[model samples]
Target chain A: MSNPKEHLYQKTAFDLVSGFKNKQWKAAEIAESFLNRALDTNKKLNSFICIPHESILDHATLLDEKRNSNEDLGSLACSPIAIKDILCTSGISTTCGSKILQNFTPYYDATVVEKLKDKDALIFGKTNLDEFAMGSSNENSFFGPVRNPWNLDCVAGGSSGGSAAAVAGQQCAASLGSDTGGSIRLPASFCGVVGVKPSYGRVSRFGLIAFASSLDQVGVFTKDVRDSALLLRIISGQDSKDSTSSSNFVPHFLDSLSIKKKWRIGLPKEYFQQGLDSEVRQALSQSISLLGKNKFEIEEVSLPHSDLSIAAYYLIATGEASSNLSRFDGVRYGYRASNPKNLNDLYKRTRSDGFGYEVKRRIMLGTFALSSGYYDAYYKKASQVRTLIIQDFQKAFEKVDLLLTPTAPFTAFKIGEKTKDPIQMYLTDIYTTAVNLAGLPALSMPCGFDSKKLPIGLQLIAPRFEEERMFQMAHYLEKEFHVQNSKHHIVL
Target chain B: MKFDIQTVERIAELSRLEFDAQEKEILLQDLSKILHYVEKLEAVDVEKIQPTYNIIESECFFREDQISVHLSNDSLFKNAPEVQEHFVQVPQMIASHE
Candidate 1:
């Protein structure tokens, strides 16, 4: 028989919920198994910045008591979910992998965190991330980079790398991550897990520390599409706290999973051009042929403005980042510089000492972009170009139901591989950023593993608030690909 | 698109950040490279397209201005670096003339 510990950790969140409800396993046993796994693998993966070991067990034990008393249980009764460090967790430090907020703890929980608690999901831990969610690789984190579980030397894609790695490493049943300019999807692609970035206002951003307001979104990283659907339903809805949140009807995502339809999948000709790794390209083509044989129409579509996405994304993301991050001045909370001669000295010294290199670089870029003379040329021009990119997606979707592309140009690269050159690192998000620009819903799931045994992710982009379609297609393709059966060759 | 030391310094001042000489040199190179790349946006034909300042098309949501329970002072100051009686402490804003 398979090891009981291994079997417990391997079960998906859906399986865990059903098994716990049926008394197959106690909630404490499930929590202990995953928590121990997280603690055991954290040394190798560095996925969690803070794993509140005792509190998680206490919460799990409370669930067991409720079940024993014949009390009604929440939908996610005994599920263990890891949260990205960017979200505020009451009494737990929400570091965002930066020294700026190292000792800071919020008095209130983020809207998503509160929702998860209401559903009785164990708040497993706070996962690591790029400092202020700035970098394409987790190397920019102050806590050090999160190593990819598949290959220890390769960097887990970021700034949600820790959340992705935690799910892939079996450290948590699911995780919550924020995506601004491909943070969630790129790491999910690299780590071979399901990463979903809902449309701009699909989820509330109230307690999520802002990176770039227009593009920032709270999303999920899960082992399977069903778990993604389940978690997405629980955390999504209109919230009074976040004005940008949509009032659109939040559907029952889990109930719609079995609905099948042949979606017209578009392959953007520009995304298929040079720079895509041959192995990833081959894997995508194979997946395409499989879909084509299964009656899904595949066609070549043009997103003419794709080449300009990166330029526009950087100008806009950094410009907003500069303004949003201005809150970190030596003030009421967070790190403060020592021995300041005056208020201005304190502001400058505290920020300089607190922020990591990438955060400072982006701040400079944003300050320059929004400066008096250059605003029209840089930020305004990029915003206008963003309109064209949005229009490009609008026109493409008029002909196709969904778009398919390689999530990243290549798989996870070695740590320190592209850190020396900021531009080289920024180019990694070439295929994933435009989706954010248009505020569309997209997901990344494993298609195949490269020859090196590293996971290759295929991204599916659907129109705004049409996540249900993306889920149906991804779930269908996931079964066809037998993604669940694929073994993770984790180093630890 | 290239940034000189003086320009980097000006931007850093605006951003309230300080960098030593070597750090400034590196920032100058990195910012120059990134800005040069983004300069390509000038070539895109966007004269007709309106800027998308806000991607969310939702209307502004307003709520009642009613009194409600909020975080107490103790909880609000829980994360403050330095706190005095019901207030956050910081460096002296006004310098005394010597």
Candidate 2:
């Protein structure tokens, strides 16, 4: 057991694939090891929503047979990865952490899933998330909140909370997650791992269950930056299924890490504001100083519209969410109430019973914003302001190549702490929501720890198609900050 | 930004969501607070600003409408509670104007 654990855990996907190709270790052995580890961790932390053990084993056996016969293997061959429940996995129940689609199994694989298949990647399981990817903490999940491996009492920041927790807990090498308003980075921050939300459309959103169509993006969480680069390399591409996906040539993300120069990393003043925990503030300052010591020039900048991001995101995301979610009218696919005599009752009962409270709240708010007389007053006004927010980033990027901030206002709070108050929960995204709203690339890497020993992340944001800058800077900071030491470790 | 029960009811209808009286009361307060905060957008001077819709650059992307042999009918209706004639069945949509 320990031998398989040593062979599987702490190894990057690329490394595992290489080992499988060289016949150093059988893919079946690696797959069984990861499965056992995942099951063991589930007893400690409920990170998985669905585990495709039998299927994964079957896939691994085939890969092993091919490898033994000296057949060609793709980049992610036999690599163990977890899919966030938001991404549709054909034949697997993709709940989106909501009761409405609780038993729903997508008929076709999402474009990302197809890409992973092309790479011969073994999807280990589907991790939990906030219902419809709505909340900042995993507590909103209908499957129940995923506990942080660091401290079971604390939350794994959501809606990608489960993905982050799984990686932090060493359940899987890497996991794919969706970020609408900092879902991926927040949990990565809380779990003390590395997660990146690519520039909008960098990764196709074809099969990702829409949270906020404009805001939602698929990202990856990994224990190391190299693995994230590898996973993103395979996943990011243009697809006809997603109209928003970019046709621009995808960059060699792995090559981006090798470029070494004295880069200018920005320190945004707006992020270091009131309500930010003092320890987190100090940790970010110290991390900035460390970066400066490493010859990376740290410039202080300002984004005045940063504070208004949460409000704007809520309005815009909910407005779009209200529209996208209208498809689940107890009519087509998904859970329908027992029996409805009329169309109104059908729509009403299915929605009321299917959606969780937070989801309903956002939908109602979104619906109100786009209502007949209120469209111009709310949704239209928000669109205009959103342009201004984008302009703020455009102007700021003119002065600095990349901006930095604390991933969240504080470290992981106790589970159920903010579920009672929706506003307080929304506040958790104060540092992260803006980057999503602006549709820029951002990466959260472990920077330091708070007094209570929870990990704090230093978020790095770069311009559109400038993911290389983020990767290089993050790699530099990873070495400079030394975030992967035993201190960041969690033993399940 | 001031919201009342009457406004909440209307908003719920527009959103096509079903909220009971208790949920409506709670939402009235929450929605009022959110509206008040978002009302700051009105403070910004946008005399000639055009409302932006789509952000990503590029347009006119069209896909050939070829029917690809994808998931089987059984798999498609696996999660549906009601199905008929290889299609999902639901109550007839009574159009608002109907």
Error of 2 at B52 (Å): 2.6
Candidate 1 C-alpha lDDT tens digits along A269-382 = 999999999999999999999998988889999999999999999999999999999999868889999998888998999999999999999999999999999999999999
Q: What DockQ does every candidate get?
A: 0.87, 0.60
Model 2, runs deviating above 4 Å: A1-7, B64-67, B92-98
Q: Model 1 fnat? A: 0.91
Each model's total of backbone clashes? 0, 0
Model 1: pairs clashing at backbone N, Cα or C within 3 Å: none
Clash total of candidate 1? 0
Model 2 pairs whose backbones collide: none
lDDT of 2 by residue, A1-492 (tens): 225546475677878888888778898888987888899889668899999889999999999888878888889998888999999988888999999998788887888988998888998899999999998989999999999988999999999999999999888889999998999999999999999999998999989989788888999999888888888878998888889999878888887787567777778888987898998898888887877776777788888878778888889999999999998887777889987877888888899899998899989888888888888888888787788888889988998888988999899999988877777889899888888878899999888888777899889999988898789888877886773345655767
In candidate 2 the C-alpha lDDT for residue B62 amounts to 86
